[model samples]
Target: MFRVDIREMLVEAQPQMIITNDNLNARVDAQVYLKVRADEDNVKASVYNVANYKLQIVNLARTTLRNIIGTLTLKSANSERGRINEELRHTLLSETASWGIEILRTELKEIDPPEDVQITMNKVVKAENEKVAAVDFATATETQADGQRRAEIKKAEGTKQARILEAEGQALAIQLVNEAAEKYFIGNAQVLRKLEAVERALVQNAKVVIPADTQLINVIGELAGVAPIPLVPKAAASPPDRK
Candidate 1:
């Protein structure tokens, strides 16, 4: 007696076809797992058609792939592989029922577009990344500028506050000196100030010029508690008229 092994088998198909949405040609490689039913009623059908069943499945898969992939653009076709696989598996399972074959699963191995399209996609990605980098750089520059502006404002405010404090300190010092002089000198503050000025002038070894006034001399001598020095008189000249 001859025996048939009804275990599942793997099938791979790489179909190169045109897409219906974009009219671009691409290659789609897929994998499928299938097996014949081991029941007695289906065993006869399996025995009669099992040898040619794989070829028929391959043709059906190619047709289904073209139909599914044709409806999608290159980008969508590349992205929606699972949808393609599911659609292909369902169609294959339904059509292969009479042949006593069961489709277990289907998968898309690869989807490759034309070289020119791939290059365009790469350029698009590069441009998008560059745009993002530019935006980030602008944001960072704006943030830095804002921070520096705030720092400068703070520094100016600090300097203004320091100046105000220094002015107040100087004003307070002048007030204290005025109060001390008023308390100690009483009515003699003016005379004491004049003496201080004269003392400062004398300390510099400056020549002193006294005015020819007896009252001023007497006032100074009275302030110093001494007798006034008498001024010498100049003699009259009469002999120049005779020449």
Candidate 2:
């Protein structure tokens, strides 16, 4: 008995090609129909010679079974894209050089994800992104606030230092001026000398001498220094410059 439905898929496919260096070695073809709905697995294995191309229906049976099982598993996995790879790899190995059929390539088509799951995942991912953004904003705000507080504290410290330094300078200046004023008013020997001088001036060749005191002497000396000087004329401008 012979079958052609599985074989024609390879034959009729566009740009179809097959290679069989080791896959069609009939030594390893034991129970090739396992887990498959195909009815004939023990065909004579030489039917491909009848077609003059050595690609009979039975020769490509193993490759067909591989493709069918791979497709079923891929569909059952909801086309999650992992089992699809395993199925394809297994097909290449199982039918390589054995079934005279080899898959050229595999590509994905459309996917139909569950609506509820998609919505839930999308919301969760969006919330996660939003949480990250909020954390960054809070961190930035805290940093700015910290910097402002430090600046204010530094300004206050500088003002306090300046006030303290000014007060210290004022205190030093007041202490010096107070000491100088006290020295000027108390026990100055120059007062006695000024009293003698005032007494000598007041006598004017008369026999009147007042009792000399230090305080009175200071008064007389201050008055004498502040008084204006009197002018004396020269001798007639030397007779009008002698013509």
Report the number of clashing residue pairs per model: 1, 8
lDDT by residue (116-179, candidate 2, tens digit) is 6447758988999999999999999999999999999999999999999999999998898467
* Candidate 2 global CA lDDT score: 0.47
Candidate 1: tens digits of C-alpha lDDT, residues 1-243: 546568999987656655657887687778889987888767667667556787888888888888888889888987888888899999998888888878999988877878898898899999999999999999999999999999999999999999999999999988985775575556766655754565577789887665655654565566568988787788887576664
Question: For candidate 1, what is the TM-score?
Answer: 0.68
Error of 2 at 107 (Å): 6.1
Q: What is the lDDT of residue 37 in candidate 1?
A: 86
The C-alpha local distance difference test score for the whole of candidate 1 amounts to: 0.80
The RMSD (Cα, Å) of candidate 1 is 10.3
Clashing residue pairs, backbone N/CA/C < 3 A, model 2: 20-97, 21-97, 23-96, 23-97, 23-98, 24-97, 24-98, 48-56
Candidate 1 wrong stretches, greater than 4 Å: 1-3, 49-51, 178-243
